[model samples]
Structure formats: structure tokens, C-alpha cells
Target chain A: MGIVSPGFSGRRRSGSELPPGQYLTRDFPVLSAGPTPHIRTEHWEFTVTTETGEATKWDWAALLALPADEITKDIHCVTRWSKLETNWKGVSLDTLLADVETSADYALVHSYGGYTTNVPMDDLLDGQAWIAYEYDGEPIDPEHGGPARLLVPHLYFWKSAKWVRGLVLSDNQDLGFWETAGYHEYGDPWKEQRYAGD
Target chain B: MTTDASYLDGNAAAGALSQVFAMDVTAAITQCNGCGQTGVFAESHVYVNAPGLVARCSGCDGVLLRVVTTPSDVYLDLRGLTYLRLPNP
Candidate 1:
């Protein structure tokens, strides 16, 4: 668990304790600060375009039918405590990205919240990422990011964007959210990459 | 009855609540048992015991303590309906 120290600047309360590293907030008010990301059914599509001549797309309905798996793990928050038990159900990122033969070396994950994170193709194929829809044995609530959220448990919690909408295959990694705000681009809980300096 | 009346009358009513008393309450620096974040509010305040209180910080989603017991230096969690005594004015 992360220890809350006094004068953590304005980012934390004067005497507030933070959860462990890697776990995202499941609490209130924290999720209520931002604008609700837009969700469009008609315009929504998960597309995978390769360097080749063809591209494949999966609509919302088509996605729900895929083989789903529930992952149980502990998550650490950048503020610092570790949430011991959490569960999420969703399609494997590898399985979803399997059909697309992208010669592009990297990929960009795009979300409805106006956020994006770039990861290498090798990382995507490694099987540690997914599009999560269920949390803690229940359908994800809107405030905690319902419909679908990206879970990259291996990285810091921030990498797992809430209300994720799409993934854009790209040749390079782009910074997202806290990454631009002094947080490490590739957050590693073990490495203590909670803030810019770690 | 006369003795009781005289005893009661010895104490005057606080004039229209217009007087102010300077009071200082100290909050302890503690950590949330759940999240492990530091600086959570204690389980007691100046004159109350707050068990199972929870508060989040604005900056980093950390848990924080809302009040403390000054005399005993006890930390109280600031959850539920704990009340704070205002300074007398």
C-alpha cells in the first residue's frame, strides 16, 4: 500500500492516505471530476487495419459474443495502497488484435475520454491487456467507467483508461492523461513510477 | 424548588449566542488502513469518537483524516455524521 505523506502538494489532501501502487480508484468523487466521455453506438467501431490491403471491424454487439475471461488480481494506485482483490471480465487484447496483421511497429489506444496511450506491438501481443466490461463480479458502473475500460494491470493504473472506446494502430507511442502531467509515460508499479521522478 | 431555582438562575444564558470562544482542534497525521495512504483522519476529534470514517483527498485520491482529539492527540476518521463544535462568537 502507498503511504500518504503530508504536503504531497495540491494533488493530495493535507493528511490523506493513498492506496498502494498500480490500483486505480474505485472510490467516489475521484471519478466524478472529469467530463463523461461520449459513447456513440452508430459511430462506434473497433477497427484493426494492417499494412496490408484489408481491415477488420467489430461493432459493439459483435464484441460481446467473444470468449470472455475473468481476471482476478491486486491493483495498486499511484496515490499508494493496493486493492487486494478485484475482478474484471473482457476479451483478451491479443485475441481482439489477432486478425489484423499490422506491419506497424507500434499502436495507439484511443478512448472516448479524449485520452490516448501508445504501446509497442510486442507489448500488445504479450497477452497482458484487455477491454474490460465487468468489475468485481458485476457489470462496471458508469461512474467507475462502464461499458468498457482498458486494463493493463502490468502498468500503472493510469494506463488503464476509463470509458475506453477504441484502439488506433499506429507506428509510435503517444502519451496520455497523467503522462503529460509529470507522470511516467510507461508506469511501472514495481518501479514506483507513480510520479514523474518515481 | 427554591434551591433548585436559585442554582439554575445562578448560571446566566449565553447572551444571544453573540460571544465568541477561541477553540483550536488538532488533527493527527495518520494513514488509511485500507489504502495505506498517509494522513488519514483519526478515529476521534476534539470531543467525539469517529469509528470507520473515510475521506478522500482532492489532489491524489488519497484518504485523509478530517478531525482529531486535541487533548488526547487522538486521530478520528471523518466519515458518517460527526459534528464539529464551532468557535463561540
Candidate 2:
């Protein structure tokens, strides 16, 4: 039998504070696939490209000028770590997608390091996500996806692309890097969908 | 937790693989069976979000190694690599 580590209870929480097969973490872990791309604020830009290839662009100042919100929510990682009551500040995806009209059902999120992930259109709208730039009242560190990252608290944290650059709308679902390599297409931590077959 | 697109390079796997191997495997040169490419293990893309650690060839994205840890065993699969040359420490 495996011995439990000290002060680490494997018991599940009563409320939604914790998800299945997940452990609460006080320290935010740094996870990335490649080297951290240091993007200057002046060079920072966000785009939303439609299926037809029409693109909407937003510079750093333009994004910061928009109405922003400070969100406090729980975040779950597919790696089985859950951070509760995390604070973030960012402009809502709703605000960014407000002017753009799209009937596409899937979103292929692109990051600066050439990383990509797919998310549902519904997950990016209706105040469900944000282009977060700050964490805990401080500018997010580069290792943690500073400048901006897509924050989708509902799905696994991986779906929240770090160093996010743009979103490409697609009529069909397109698997991103990890998804192509055997990760679950739709990562739902609640269901423990960590791998392709899961 | 591993994310769908979040991945680290083989450098991240050094710490984990060290537990099983006597030498630092990340510095080892591995030949990709799929692409015939040779490079340091640290250059391979490492995915830790899944049930195990998967290292893929950067040249071809072909899986070079996989390490799965269970309650009583650590399963390692290196069939994707043609050969792994580790330096003597």
C-alpha cells in the first residue's frame, strides 16, 4: 500500500472546491512545453480570426483600455492539482468577441511559442473566459504566461493557453499540439479526461 | 496537471528519469526511429500532463520515450528511439 505524505489528505472536499482525483495546491506550479517567449507590451497584440480569415486585432494598450474585471475562481489542472480562489485581472473574451460575428463552434487558440489548443466557442463567450494579464494583483510572471493568457476556468488549465496570441474560429474541431499527441480533445478535469481514450 | 497543449522539453524529464537511471538522461543523445534525427534528449518535447511522462522527438514529434509510474512499478517505453547514447559520469 502507498503511504500518504504528511499533511496531505487524499480525502475529497465537500463542495466544488476540489475536483475528482485532484489535490489542492497552495503554490502555483510552472508548466510549459518550450522556452518562455518574452514579448514586449508594445509588440503585444491579440487577434480573433474568423473562419473566412477575417481578423480582428487588439494591441496591448487597446486591450488594457477596455473594461476589465478582477475574477476570483478555482482552477484545475489535468495533472491533478487544483488551486482554489485564485485571483486574476483581464478583459473578458466577451468584450473581445463582441463586435465579431461567427457561427463557428470551435476555437483553435494560438500562443506565441507556436503552441495551440482547441476550445468550444461557447466556452469563450458569455463571460466564461478572459485574456488575463495579472495574477494576485501583480503582473503575471513570464514563466506563468505573462503579457496575457487565455483563462478558461471551466476546463482543465491546459486549455487556458499561455502566452496566448490569437483565436482562429473553425467550423470543425481541430486538435492542438497536445491533443494531436494523445491528450483528450475536450479536457474536462471533472471527468478526468487526461488522455485521448479517457 | 498537464494541459492539452502545454508541454516542456526533455530537460523537464531529467529529474524524473534520474530516479531510475544512474546518469542524467536528458544530456543523452537519442536517435529518432521515425525521422532518423539525432539530438540531445533535452531537446525532445516532454508532456507531463497525462498519466505519464511522454518525450517526443522535436524533429518529428514522434514519441521517443514514455514513463508511467504506478503504485508499485515504473514502466518505461523507449521503442521509438533507435538508440540512446548516455555519457559516462
Model 2 chain A weakest 10-residue run by lDDT: A1-10
Q: Model 1: how far is A56 from its true place, Å?
A: 3.5
Please give, for residues A52-108, the per-residue lDDT of candidate 1 as tens digits.
536678777887888776676555555454554467888887789776667777666
Best by TM-score: 2
CAPRI docking class of candidate 2: incorrect
Q: Which tens-of-lDDT digit does each residue in A17-67 have in candidate 2?
A: 577889888899987655567888899999999998999999999999998
Error of 2 at A44 (Å): 0.9
Q: What is the interface RMSD of each candidate, in Å?
A: 21.5, 8.5
Query: What are the runs in model 2 whose C-alpha is more than 4 Å off?
Result: A1-17, B1-89
For model 1 chain A, the run of ten residues with the poorest summed lDDT: A6-15
Model 2 agreement with the true structure over B1-89: per-residue lDDT tens digits:
11334678789898779878998898899999989999999998897755468788888666788776654556677778999998767
CAPRI quality of model 1 = incorrect
Q: For each candidate, what's the DockQ?
A: 0.01, 0.11
